[model samples]
Target: MAVGSVALAGTVSGGEFANPHLCQKGQQLLLYFRTIYGKQILAGYNVYPHTPDDYQQTGRHAAIWGRDIQWLGDVDEVIAHVQRHGYILTLHWHWFFGGDSAWTRERKTPVVLDQLLKPGTPEHDTLMRELSKTADVLEKLQQAGIVVLWRPLHEIDGGWFWWTDLQHPENTAELWRVMFRYFTEERKLNNLIWVYSAGVGDLKKKPPEWRRRFYPGDQYVDIAGIDIYGVDLQQDETPYWDYFRAMEEICPGKTLALCECDAIPNPDKMVAGKTPCWLYALPWWGCPHPRRSVDWARFTMGHPQVITLDELPLFDDASYAPELGILRPADDGGAWFPNSVPVIEGFVAGRGSPVDLLQFLVDDKVVAEIRHPPRDFSWTWPGDLHGTFELTARAYDAAGKQNLSNRIHIAVGVRNAARSRSVRASSGTNPEAAVDGSYYSGWHAAKDAEDAWIEVDLGSPVEISQVNLIWGWKIHPAKFAVEISRSAPDDSERSWETVSLLEDLPWQPWKATHRVRFAPRIARAVRVHAYQRAAHQTWAGYDLAEIEIPIPAR
Candidate 1:
């Protein structure tokens, strides 16, 4: 339940805003944008369910409920806030039932839509009960005068969720139809404006018939939308535009939208071309958060054609067209911006390539070149390399044309197991597992062990430059200290010095590799001491996928 701010109000009944009775208020709002598509676009922002009310101060025209709203206990409060703010509410459901049954407790295993769609099964009954409960909540909101843009089972072209099955299109299509019928007809929830959304990949790969394969039908859908991210926005947007064309062919006259995007589309670029007919755009909630820049919001919100909350007409106003004016055609043909540079996607581990390559480079200098390279290859650096380096790849065809890939910047220290003679953990299964150079295997402290340590013997005194630690699947030390010990050969004198102290490390379910570089020092042994585990860890112990200690090549 993410939120955004606006400064306007409106009232309306079904279809008046769009087809005058065929569509609901929410649908009308979408159609209103369609009517003015080429001339104007609407700016929307998502709100987290728990985000403070002041979050609405951003002056966005529309508000989206974050994916987590499906599981939240305070949905009523979220709806009330949207109504109070006079925002056109849109809801995205990231159903968690597919992953964990413990969260819902209605089933013994994860919910499978294919099985649940079949009647008379326990799974089907449980899912229906759960969905009915949600419908009951939305029914109350409708009774209270809230019309929602309901986007469920979104991104069905992606395989990330149970509701999506790109390979089994028929199954996903049936699942969608079942849900739509159950909600619209069986439950009698008419206040919702159904939005049919597919991942950008669906639009890109599927043939023209792909639209028909997953479409529930125009009667069940009011808007055709897609979710896009900016990670590769600059590289290509053909699929984005293709979606608009597909929707026009499949559900002509229905409004098209950028339902979810990490970055807002450039207004000038979007409106310039035979504009792709995007009626509105809703950027995901975190775009303007600490990690992302507010430039996206600033640009879209300031665009002349973008409708902000303050500029929106009352929903029931019949004279809104006079205020908005007619759509205008583009002055010039749109320019296509495509990346001319070679695109690259691959990663290197330590100092080597994980896949075969025609050429490997470090800092734009070709270091290795292979003819008839294998599917995978590795190249050793000048072992003494201890700082950051940029790596790139180049492949050549028989015609001698060169194709370059994106550059990957990586530090060249922390080689695991090479210098480590023996490793010992204070208390754990397979103490030496951390140095085994396998992500699947790791050193695990005893179940009850809170504070733990893993010491590595380098066999002899060496100049240690950096230490890298990879966290395992379950547990990660939130607070830890890396220490170095320099001891005399006779074992008579020893001194331990803290080399690095890390606190408040974030916990992640997947393995994350972190490297810590320090001033070169001479030490016989190095140790990592864990002070605490991240809160999400199921066990009170320390776990590490791998430990690396790289000594400078002398």
Candidate 2:
């Protein structure tokens, strides 16, 4: 196959299969994920809950529920219930053989791929028996007219599974092909939608090259997926977006899915065009990870963009599908100073389709056409242009199918006066570090102090509209007041005017950036007065990684 020659699933309708050439389906079923479902993401969960209605705490059932086939006694009952309720069904198998679990052999004594494929060998026999058993269950589902999103040999390159061998991608691909043929041709199980899932490799590595190594080809896959767990969605979603783009290039016309996840990403962010559109997400079952809670689940399930079980449509709806979202400048928009070049970024979804041209538009005019791989989804504006303008993007595939991004309005000539400015704090310890433009260093207040304050001198009176406080690692002030003064900071008799009184800051135990925007004001000095520290904070005083003051115009 050519690098990006395959036609994408952009034109396929929701709930329908893709053309057989794209995969085994007649029409792209998950094309809707990047189109209609782009605005309505399918939320799912793994395994059943202890209590029948435990997940109802989110006020609704997920659109799909996945399970390890080994845990169920009667797969038919579960299949019937899922199908009867109009919910999607997904299943996986953790093969146990020779007293070793699926994850027990890869590192120590891995299953040799070649031996497993050689029919007469013991390894081959073991695989055939397991495949037969799994096929029998799938055959039952097929007989019952139930469609399954089946994930077998998941995370093939993760090195945790018995079949994994990063150096021999061809072997992994062959293993998948063998299973694909056994289940589809021999067993004649047509109800399964094959999902090829990759593992989230080293947390620090965000490139997609490693994932592409394990791909078994488009003919053997209906959906390309990745398993995400333990990563805090509250922090940054860049890694997920990066992989989302990676998978699209790896399998140009396959539906992209989150086979397994820990935290359910915020749908609001998706609606705001901050992340890629996934076909569906199945969060691991049971106790919520610390990053996720019932409240968060409720928020995700209840959001209009997040489609729960009841929200799924009865029939296929294709109309038009395209998922191009502007992830930079934010959906809320941004303001930059004149002569400041801003980076524009976006996400393209829908069967991990390849983008031929990602054109950055300003007020409907093409500013730049990003032709290279959107590794970071980043494109720097060529010139330092200033003024309020509407921003949007258009991504065209090889077939010229267009995916339009969400539009945002941004203004230039907004300067950050606090950058490299004279800053001081009550602690009198390296106060300048807070405005040093480095998140690595911060200023901490006096130990066990009842109060703390950090002030910045803007050099000259500038109209400041926003103040961004980058909280230090796990430390933030619960209550703080932003005060401005027209007089010099050293003046003992200078009067300070309270501009904004912020309180009850949420406990987001991470280095998070919080923004406070107020009516534009001209002030020579701005200071933050901290009262109570955030809950569970072990530090004695308020700490800040960096502070930014954006003046709408000088």
Candidate 3:
């Protein structure tokens, strides 16, 4: 059983978490973000259809969702369906002031702010009622062992919501503290991960530093985030970069996220702009203008650095087993060139018997063994390495039960065998481009071909273990097979043996590498056969940047 699988009623001790295991899981999730910050980004969205559309287009689900309070009643059902399936959850309330809609700019007033903060006032009573109601909903989740990323009074500096005290904006900070104290001390809702969101005002007028004026201090917040929209989606994203830096300055050491966005930031552009990667992104749903297209969704969701729903680990498992996670060499399929030694770091999580030992394995062979593992342990590759390797960590508890961490694949000291090799295609414009070793060039199949394929002749049978595919910018074929042929290089009707049948390929954006590893085989030729194009593509054929078969060191 998972953490939320069982529901418990009543209060937990000392305002502590109702489910300690679930809290550990939440910490693990935060560690995951911390490890990836400045390195990678997580793909997220808001509400239901966005989730489904993400899955439909990318063959993967968005990692997280910012759920609106408007649909508070269905939250439990939503949690059972999505959260149980590894989707991270956050709640955003568009509070109504005295029953008035949050959208009315006139609802934000100095008089209302004063009344809401002052006791014995009608507005203060209303504030208590609303906060208590929200607390009750959160308590339900706590009872069910679910940890929430709770975001309240978002866009406080935007002057569009009642929570925004435009006349005396400092009152907004006090308001956040009040809710923090109420929910944490009074209601004992310790399952929440508090998020303080700043509004991205007109950069030209207000500038990024304007956000610092409303911060409620670091102690009261867990994550520092911002909501940006209508910003230019260019390679040089100076505005967003400045905003993220400002957030870092204001809430130093806090994880940053795009809590609400009209456009998802591209990981490649973020890296190019020298901007720190966002922990996650939550874009609004179904907006007609600035709407995320299928291709755009595929690009963001499929990027190797972006974490999809399917990539989330099982944090709530209830088995009597220790949980292990890898913390270093973060990107699973990242390639480390020849002679680079990778430092492996990991931890054993949850409540159970202490881990007796930790064994770090490379390709199923134990390379380093720790007799008594600490809360976190480290191991270094003993020598310069070569070949494609699968790395994992196994933890053995005192009683001898063991658990394994998720596996990560990396290549070291390997050269692309398919480069400058003979190539052929059934129907494609530039089939040779796939082996040309150029990121910008690729082979594109003819639209009329029902079963499209491109083959690379290795000149003669050589020992090979893996293939790395760098896909074209806008086109991807989710279903394909990697086959090897031992027949003579000149043979037209070569007998092809399928080594790997991939039905759903991970969303790897343009020039991003997706590796397929298999047992070592002797083959003169290898080919990728495409059965179908991605469902949402208007392009009639498949396309990819390069197909590389890495030759392992002998």
Candidate 4:
């Protein structure tokens, strides 16, 4: 089938899936991919059996895809299972029959691409039957109001698949075109958003050649996706950036995605690196090993940029204005101090109409309202509120329609005392490290040091209500005292007084934070004296990750 012959009449405009709304003029798949852009990214999970019902049970991903459908009964059943949830569905086909019969030892060499493409050949007939079965399922889904992010012949640039070992790279492209024609023209499956995906490893092994060789052309693809693994997921390594940029240069106008990842990328690193173009990421599932921990999952999914399954909108609602989406004091990362005013911020992506007003809600009650809100809106909470609270924002369009944003869970308490403070140690140590705003880096005292002392300069005389200390590995203090002083440590007129004393502090295998609240004291400097060191398996000196002091409201 000629690629040009396929009519574009029923092709779903990629723009329809862009933005927070169903159908608005914006970047394609931006709603699902870059919902938080610079600040957050969307989280997705792939499950075994690939059924929508099973995915719903996990309650993790905003988008779901499946592989190994044969193991889950039938392809149509899997499609039906996924269609029920109306999720952003992606499908992966592991073509084991390419050449080596790894699944079965019966076939060693798969038929050549030329033979498979030729009419009246046994290989051609066999391949057609398989394609017809998939197309049949997709046709049913199309009739049922489902659009699939269909990724067939994936990882074809890698040598592991039969399709990848074709005599020439053009042969693989031909195979892709054949499959595209069969699904779109022969079977009339317009609900598919064709994705041209390749493995990052193959791109590295083959370099620039692999991208050009395997590409099926812009006319045949809507999104360019890459499968990445076996690297540090915590950092945005060079390989990922290379492939991301290559896809943009190679495909030019198509959207980009992380088709399959063994380790989810760190949200902070992704944002810091400025590669927010990733529309969505689907991490391969099989816990406690290649998959990330529950903490990592929670952090990524709860980020502002990431849209989980529960957060995604119904396909039918894409044409309307999206419900308000919270932008600040992130759901999981946000914290408020007791007796301190906390500001809540969010925005509604108005679909064609202007937003008339925005109402900020605390525990379902309207706390603040803004008329004719700007592109973004914010409201400050009453300072007296304490304990845990839930926050949400609602927006009203010009027509008076209302929509609510996601809920943010926050705790009102004494803020971190050590943040944004200058520190000095009595004896030589990396005192400044403790206040650097990172858990991995901390202040370390001299080896076997005893009676170690660290002092913090608040830069001004402020009322302090609490002191929080975070201990590093095998370096907790057994006894400590918090002291306050009005003058510099070296000043002859300086007066120091103990404000809080802690004894017999417990040790933890992992770093832990200990909070101590005291009667509010006004001072310019605070000191922590370690009277004794806990029995250490390694070093006996003190090590502190952070020192937090919360100032009470006036």
State the C-alpha lDDT per candidate: 0.59, 0.67, 0.69, 0.63
**Can you write out model 1's per-residue Cα lDDT over 356-375, one digit (the tens) per residue?**
33676766888767665432
Model 2 misplaced stretches (Cα beyond 4 Å)? 1-37, 48-54, 105-109, 203-207, 287-291, 315-554
Error of 2 at 266 (Å): 1.6
Runs of candidate 1 with Cα error greater than 4 angstroms are: 1-24, 27-31, 49-68, 98-114, 202-204, 231-239, 289-292, 316-554
| Tens digits of per-residue lDDT for model 4, 258-349 | 88887457766675764444766878753322245434655565565565544554434332343456656643222545555667665454
* Candidate No. with top TM-score: 3
Q: For model 3, state the Cα shift of residue 148 in Å.
A: 0.8
Model 2 vs. true fold: TM: 0.52
Worst 10 residues of 2 by lDDT: 1-10
RMSD, model 2, all Cα superposed? 15.6
Error of 2 at 175 (Å): 0.6
The estimated TM-scores of all candidates read 0.51, 0.52, 0.53, 0.51
- Relative to the true structure, candidate 3 reaches a TM of 0.53
